[model samples]
Target: MALGPIQFYCNTAVALICGIALWTDCSSRRISNRLILIGLICTGAVVLIEVYFKGDWQNAGGRLAAGGFASFLHGIPYVSGQMGAGDLKLAMVMGLLLGWDAWHAYMGYYGLVLGTAALILCLVPAKHKPWSLPLALF
Candidate 1:
């Protein structure tokens, strides 16, 4: 799908937020709530603007539903203590921004990346294996 200017800018903002989250996760092994909040707020603003200009409330509603669904699915891992809250929030933001199909593709690619990382980590024994899969994801 071709992205319009606003969508492109929104994606850029998301990328920047992801970079910040990545840095914080790698350095401190934590993704701050503030970072996720920023991402959510920015995405909300963009969606609001789109709805205002395009008069497409249905699209905005769909985005919200997609995000909620993605968040719900990710909540399972969070509840199991296998994923961080920030990671779940990030997935929600991604679904909001990219919609369900894109979010699914992104998650598939993320799983592949995580699997490869895990395989490599297994091959090379380290003194301390990183416990944060979300951090590795970033």
Candidate 2:
């Protein structure tokens, strides 16, 4: 699907935020709540504009539902302590920006990449295995 100007801008912003998240995660081994909040606020603003000003409520709602769904799906891992809250928030923001189709594609690619990395990490016994999938994702 072709992205409109607002969608394009939102996607770009998400990409930039993801890069920042990656750097912070790698350097500090933690993704900050402030960064996640920035992304959520920015994406929420875009969705609000689309729904209120552009009268594109259907698309906006769909994207929001997708994000909610992603949050729920990722929340399981977060609750289990398999992933961090920031990662869950990041996944939600990505779903909000990409919608269902694109989010699905992105997750498929992410799973493939992450799975491969995990497999490789398992092969070589190291003192520490990478703890942050979000950093590897970015």
- List CA RMSD, all candidates: 2.3, 2.4
Worst 10 residues of 1 by lDDT: 129-138
**Alpha-carbon runs more than 4 Å astray in model 1:** 126-128, 131-138
Error of 1 at 9 (Å): 1.8
Which candidate comes out best when scored by lDDT? Answer: 2
Quote model 2's TM-score: 0.83
Q: Write the per-residue lDDT of candidate 2 for residues 1-138, one digit (tens) a residue.
A: 787888688778878888888888777768888887887788778878887899987778778888998898888988999888788888888888777646767778778987987788888666666544444263
Q: What is the TM-score of each predicted model, taking all chains together?
A: 0.82, 0.83
